[model samples]
Target: MDAAARARLIRALAGTVIAHADELTGLDQAIGDGDHGLNMKRGFETVLAEADTLAAQPLPAMLAGIGKTLVMRVGGASGPLYGTLFLTLGKTLPEESGMADAAPALEAAVAAVKARGKSDAGQKTMLDVLVPVLEELKAGGEGLPARLAATAHAAAEATVPMRAVRGRASFLGERSVGHMDPGARSSALMVEAVVTWLEEQA
Candidate 1:
């Protein structure tokens, strides 16, 4: 994606989180700290506010700022986990860039989330959506954004039937079986937002 597309994608993420804030809060209430949406909204609000400054910055720089903001502002496990994902990406990404290669960034992001979250595909975490979606992106090559949207949507839907194995949901044991993971749900939304923005860019 180009500089303009990058900016728009980030803004769309921020807006998507804000738009679904209540639903996110509700989802979190089912299996987590109940603040997934709230904290994310706050972090992305900070992201949106800094958009002007970040507009001309490299992708890694923009991600680094977001990571720092989340680490500082958000609370509980989300602050550290999500913070680490973005922070790791910021540290790992290429420097002196032109337009970012979207697929690689998404793949890196999925890896960061998996590493930080410390859970696998069957755990019904964000990995269910992220891992498969990244795989599809890598496999499809072209039409990646559309595939990502389908994958995320499928993963989010799949979460409803699986038991939670990570985070606070693990505490619930069998009770966690029915409810959706807040993080996974929101992660799916994030993927969808990126796909939407990518389509618009196209």
Candidate 2:
């Protein structure tokens, strides 16, 4: 996607996070500190407020700025984890390209997030959703947004049966199994927002 499209996707993602903040907070309450929603909302609101400035930057610069804002404004582990994800993407992405060109950047982002969080897939973390989405992007095909939407949601749902081995939810043991990981849910929502914006572009 182009810069404008990227900006739109970010805006939509901010909206999605805000809209689902309460639900996210509730999910966190079941297994975490119950602040994921508020943290995400505040971070994304700052992103929205800085949208014009961000959109004006080069793609990498814009993404880096977004990551920085989230890191600075958001609370909890999510801030640093998500910040690293986006910052890595900014650093890794190639200039002037499409999803195919974005694949490596996204892949690098997954690794960065994994390292930053010191976590992996099937651990009831955001990686449950992100890893699969990265796979889909790397494969590169038509109806990308549709495929990403499905994969993201499915991965997020799959977290319902997983035991958290990382982050605050890890403290819950079996009790965390049935509850959806708030970070995974929020990751899915962010991906879904990207899909929505891409569909509009098409």
Tens-place lDDT per residue, model 2, 74-143, is 9999999999988988888765656666778888999999999999998999999999999998787777
Best by lDDT: 2
Collision pairs in model 1: none
Per-model C-alpha lDDT, please?
0.79, 0.89
In candidate 2 the C-alpha lDDT for residue 125 amounts to 93
> How displaced is residue 8 in candidate 2, in Å?
1.7
Off by over 4 Å in 2: 1-4
Each prediction's RMSD to truth: 2.2, 1.3
TM-score of every model versus the real structure: 0.89, 0.96
Quality of model 1 by C-alpha lDDT: 0.79
